[model samples]
Target: MDSKKSIHLLYAQYLANKISKDDLALLLDQLASMSTEELALLTAKFHSSEQISDLKNTEFNSQKTLAFIQDKIVVEEPRKRNKFTAWNTIIALAASISIFLLFKVIYQKDSSLFRATQDSSLSSISNQAYLSLILPSGETLHYSKDLQLLSNNSLALPTKDVKLNVLEKGQLAFEFSLEFIEKFKNKTYLIATGSQASCTIRLMDGTLVNMNGKSSIQLPTIFSKEFRTIALHGEAFFDVSHHKTWPFKISAKETEITVLGTSFNVKAYQSDSHVLTSLSSGSVALDNGTHQVKLTPGMEGYATKSKGEFNTRKISIQEIGMWRSGFFTFHEEPIIDIIQKLAQWYDIDDIQVVNDHRETFSGSLSKDKSLTQILKQLEKVSNSKFEITERRILIMR
Candidate 1:
């Protein structure tokens, strides 16, 4: 039988409490191998089917099944050779299944879950925003409003301030405020923000990082006694804690920024051709392997992918990290670049420029404004027309 049919049969057996251990393992393995699109389709099919509904109403108990599955996962995890990848996939599968089952129960009791909003399409787009935490053991944890709801209702997820400590041997330790602690650690952890989403993280040593949309940062759970180092992709504003004995370092694409204690903004998205580091306070040294430059407050250091050399220019201190303050500030930025920024913030996929306008614009706009409102302002300033259809935008000049 095909994979979907096999999964359907196995799931039905599970709901009826008749699936064997081998079949349950097979089901999870197959589900893990499927792509996100495939899994979503399967979920929709399962939810719409009368057979599954009948089984759920009559025979299925979510709590018992969840416990059984958790036990199976614990038993099977040790058998996998590539534990990291396998464990992450298994955890994601478990969460997906748990949420799917739980949502069914919640929906039956509360139809308010499906209530429509005025801007349903915009709501759908916003739903795609998320923050992901990848632990060293390859376990991935996701945080979002929707996931928070599910977690609050059923999952024992940690809420509020939590500290992470990296332990030896792929173990991670979580220190929760309520004196709840757990041992799960690795040397490094990755924090990522999805499109249209931003997040702030406080490092163990009191460094504050404000991440932009579609950005990622990788740092050790605990900094070494000598120095603090972290890798960055995309963009972030960092407020480094003053540690007189230890220096802080950021590794971006083709550039390394070292400082004692200072506030700075770094934009190094891999898709972009240039890496930019703007200093707001104190001093920082930027090295791009071939060349090095020191930047003081009000100075911006940039390196192009083609030249891969450090270049410095003076920029207004107020222009640094404007996004963090709910504003988009552009200073003679190319029209395409401006549109791309909007696309990243709005999570819009389809963008078309009707004419090849090499116009550069300089202005500031509030992020609180709607896409249409912002576009209208841009049209007035740049003498360009913007047409929005759903999540797609067209520009003409």
Candidate 2:
């Protein structure tokens, strides 16, 4: 059952004076997960119900409601210390009282909402745009995508003389020099893409890395004698140079992808629990020492650190690195996972899913369109409804 639906049911039962202590505890936990905007929406939605207005006769303990919500936030997920803000706690408490009071009205007037599912809609919304480049000197440059790179040597960045050559979108070319090559032999630099941005980088080794939005890669100034290793925090499509002796290796959390010279896409964000690697051509080995799997063209490899399991299955060739190519491939994927992708690409925070979404959905969306345009397409497939605010997105059912 959806957590939000469970909360409504529990709220109804509580108003009827029949809720158990366990149900109340669960309700508090669910409420804590909701963002402040969502809580406000919940209160405002039922505030207008005629049935609720007549529920003034019902009595409730305000102090106990506040206490329960506060206690839950403190102790519920001790490991998630960064999950809550001071303002969110205040919103939760305010929501708790409003929820406790409004249920009497909702139960009496709008009981049908308990059985309601989700609907999605889209309106005009805007996303902030900027990309981050961390130099070897620890200085950061937050530049817009339209800004061109003026320097001929891509590796000679973070310098005042660095120039911009506004190349066409999705174009990546790296011109190297023996002097510049020697300069970056052992040094490392970082590149990060924003919500509305994508970048193609040519490495010192002639390898091309096409980074998707909200993705990052850390590359060395020079490849080691034995291996060409890079660390990835998000998603990227790699076109590696063929080196029989110096194989390309990518580290994403607990998983490592190794290939001699191949084209592959890796989606392994640090925030995500599972790391996904899809090979378009050439053979690649996904290894974490304890478990290893080899992927062929049109093959997808999935590994979860928690389970410590590596699994492989065949997918379509088109699905590999579709985002960079301009589309999203969602197959048996959760709505939350999809939203996380949007959050990263859009540079959005405060995404709230009111209900538990155990259902999986499959489809494709174009990346060329705006956020609202893509969301309207999403509404046709999912049971959840979308409410886009100034920057936050609220999902309800």
Best by lDDT: 1
Show the lowest summed lDDT stretch of 10 residues, model 1: 112-121
Error of 2 at 375 (Å): 2.7
Q: Candidate 1 regions off by >4 Å?
A: 1-127, 145-186, 388-392
Model 2 spans with C-alpha error above 4 angstroms: 1-131, 149-170, 173-185
For 212-317, candidate 1 gives per-residue lDDT tens digits of: 8877777655666777888787789999999888999887765778999999999977556788899999999987656889999999988765547777899889
- lDDT, model 2, position 156: 43
lDDT of 2 by residue, 1-397 (tens): 9866876776665545555445656666665566555554665654665545554323233334556665765665454444346335444544565555455334334322211100000010112334555544444445656644322224545343332233465554334345654665555556666676788877768788888877777765466787887778778999999999899988776677899999999987656778899999999998764678899999998875653779899888987888876777788888888887777677576688898977788877777778888787777777888889987988887
